[model samples]
Target chain A: MDFSAVRSVAVLPFHDLVGDTRAADRVRDTYMGMLLATRAVYVLPSGEVNRGIARASIRNPQQPTTDEIVKLKKELGVDAVITGVLREYGKVRSGSAEANMISLSLQMSETQTGSTIWSGSSTKGGISLADRMLGTGGRPMNDVTVQVINDLLDQLFE
Target chain B: MICSTSCSNRFLLLPLALLVVLLLGGCAGLEHTTVSSSGNTDLPARLEEGALYALLPIENLSASRAPLAELDMQLRNALKERGIRLLEPERLETFMREQRMRSRGGINLTQSRALRDLGVAGVFITALETWREGEVPRVSLIMRLVQSGDEPEILWIDGVGRTGDEAPGLLGLGLVKDVRQLTAGALERLLDSFVAARSGAEPGTAAQKKRHQPKYRYRAADFDPAAEYRVAVIPFLNVDTREHAGRIVGLHVVRQLQRYGNLKVLEPGLVREALLSQRMIMQEGPSLEAAELLAAADVLGADLVVSGRVFAYEGDAGESKVDFSLQIFSGIEPQVIWTSHSYGGGDDGVYFFDRGRVPSAHELAGRLAEAAIGDFAQ
Candidate 1:
């Protein structure tokens, strides 16, 4: 349960389960930014991670397998790899025309054994009373995203 | 008080039943309305579609992202169907993911670097105004193409809108459909412009489009567009009611000039910096006497200064209106080289609203920007 040795981590592409690849990418990024802001670990440069993905010749970057993580660790020289699945990201509407829904889950795994060290999931950014009454919708995805990431990281870091 | 069975609860039952009926009957009045977005562009022919192109995320202005997200996917499929080769979305998303994290959500060097790494010929950026599903559908999409590199240069742009020809609903019971058919129809016509430009063929969808042309006037008759000059466009003196109208219009003018691929337009940031160094706020309109312009231009290392004012900008989902004036000053002499005044609005809010000509504020702004540039930009 100790992440004391987790000095460095690299965030990989998240699986876009709901067919919205952009939402998946966006949510994964918020997670990465939150992780970086923690100053908890030396997050490997995104450029290096991109290069590692390319070097590994991963056909489906969305679902990075254990071997790919091992390869990324070797190339990027990171201790752990961060990856996640985006179950549901984007909006649901009842003629309101507002994006007030988001859902995602993430995890950080040990590279050598591909064993999960820490994991977190969140389903936030939903409609509220004010949204329906005013027809204005709920909080923007960005703000809600920060809250979601904070919740996830708190579970992992604490 | 908690009602035991039927005595006190009878009163609550009536109100609850009424509420349910009201909610159910609310949609009975759902009237079907047709909204169209007509778009045509002057994009040149002879594009290399087989070469690599990158599609950035579309800017969703309609407060919701799901519809636009679907539109983005539809656009990719549509363009691919039209024989355009796009950089794999996974790789592009990967690059952007890093860019977001490293730049902390700002436009940074990563886009340029990613463009280089991907070895793309062009980048496709777009804005989705209205995309939804129903018997009577609405769609407005504007696409902007920029030639790739460190400094991505604008190549083409156009805004379009169109309404689905759906039959009237029986007491609001029917709405044709959503997503599949509506998106297919819109994307078919929308992406066709890319091919139309290259094949030198007229687009069938653009048949109803009404093109607008803006005129120009210059104070200095001898000012030449052929001259190689670095131009600076200061923030407009916005008299428009819209907040930040001046700043937005200035940016629009810069993009318009940049798209022309002529006239060395200095970065507005550089002009702002120079103005700041002079302890001057360049928010004033073109009335900046030629001497003041010359000083600002000289300090900013420019030969021409473009200044303007956005007098008005009004718009809604149905249509939009704008009025503005523009002027250009020569850095060497205290003389105004050129000036222009123009205004425009979509033909909307009429009995034939469906058949009328209505352009968005952005499209109208583009028209004004073109007029602002006039001969100089070309």
Candidate 2:
């Protein structure tokens, strides 16, 4: 989590395990917007990063090889890259109860060493006690998503 | 006892019938009507009604998991009802499987040739853009007819988007509660236009839907208006929160480009096929990079390439907002020829009580796109 060597980062598209085809892009977009707003680290424009990825001919976007990582850095002029996976992101139901949920993990790797510099995971939202007691639908999906992303960012910068 | 029971039942039904009649009469002013209309009805003259046609699988571009199978069936039935000869479903399915055609949303030149060999004259490519079923239902469907020949050219294309509560009568009881009925009404209107065009009725005149002189626009000074340029529209980058906003905007731009007589707009499916084959991915959004633009133009055989970004396409509480920018690059050289930025809300010009307010984001996007490309026609 050292910030000395990491000046810029490329956030790859998150992998979605959820059945929804759009979950990956939607979550990644939110992450990009929030991460950029923090202004903690210089983030490459998604278009530039994608161009680098395409130019490198990386077969797997979320899991680029070490050599591909170096190539992406050379192409995009970024010091580090971030990859993420969305394990569960949507509404979950248990019998008669339903609530929004998000489970995600992210890792940052420096291009020079091509090794993971920092990694974090976050999971939030479910059928809560208050939700059940009041018979409410729980938090909106966007709220849960933002909360999970915020938790991860806090860990990343800690 | 039986006679007494029958008499009681009749007495009960008479009052209920009377009540129904009274309510209907009272709510007559509030009758809701399904409004479905299309743009661009000028179909190719060579298209014959007797020619056999096949409906490719309807593409579901909507965020909602609309019943695509039901829609396909409905379209097939509607085609049959209109006396249009369709290829046998089993035969078409077999051909699709044999050819390993993964994308039925569009037909490439090779597929078109193969269909021609199979005695099919044309193919229908349909995309269900929007389908929301609830208290107020909304449906948007776009259909295109491509001739199955050496060159797979789009013969006719039109789309219709409608919301259930688009027109509420006196009591609001006229609201359409069922999505299927709304879809049917839209389909009926689309077919009517197609039928009318085929029967030699003059295609509806192009009406000016939206007009705005762009504040930021660039056009090449030496641009020729009569140039026969082949154009390919890339999927616009969706930076908006709305799902599929990029594709929707791109489609609207394509529709606008198709209206220009000097430009030959390439089928989006073919453009997609080329992009995939070339392994060119616009990951972030539209890129103005010289190398990539030239590569795309060469691969797609496009004289001009169009790319764009959608910043906003959202509708909340009956107000619609759309913001986007479009850039057209020359294929011969990796340089921009035309660029324009457009942004507006549904109530932009509405002063009085919502007389000119746009009802949905889809329509607003269409108008913005039209206004952005308005100068091109001149």
| Cα-based lDDT for every prediction | 0.59, 0.72
* lDDT at residue B85 of model 1 (Cα atoms): 89
Cα deviation at B94, candidate 1, in Å, is 2.8
Which tens-of-lDDT digit does each residue in B241-283 have in candidate 2? 5787788778778767766667788888777878777777675
TM-score of decoy 2: 0.63
User: Which candidate tops TM-score?
Assistant: 2
lDDT at position B8, candidate 2: 100
lDDT of 1 by residue, B1-378 (tens): 355666668878998987665544433212222221211233444256468887877766433334656767888888888788898989878867875633211122346556767788777777665554554555556565666555444455445544443222333334435546655765675566556555554322212222334332434557677777767777776562465566556655765665443466654434654665566543333332432544553466567777766656654344566666666767766445665555566542223323334434555565556555644455
Best by DockQ: 2
Chain A TM-score across all models, in listed order? 0.89, 0.95
Model 2 whole-model lDDT (C-alpha atoms): 0.72
What docking grade does candidate 2 earn? incorrect
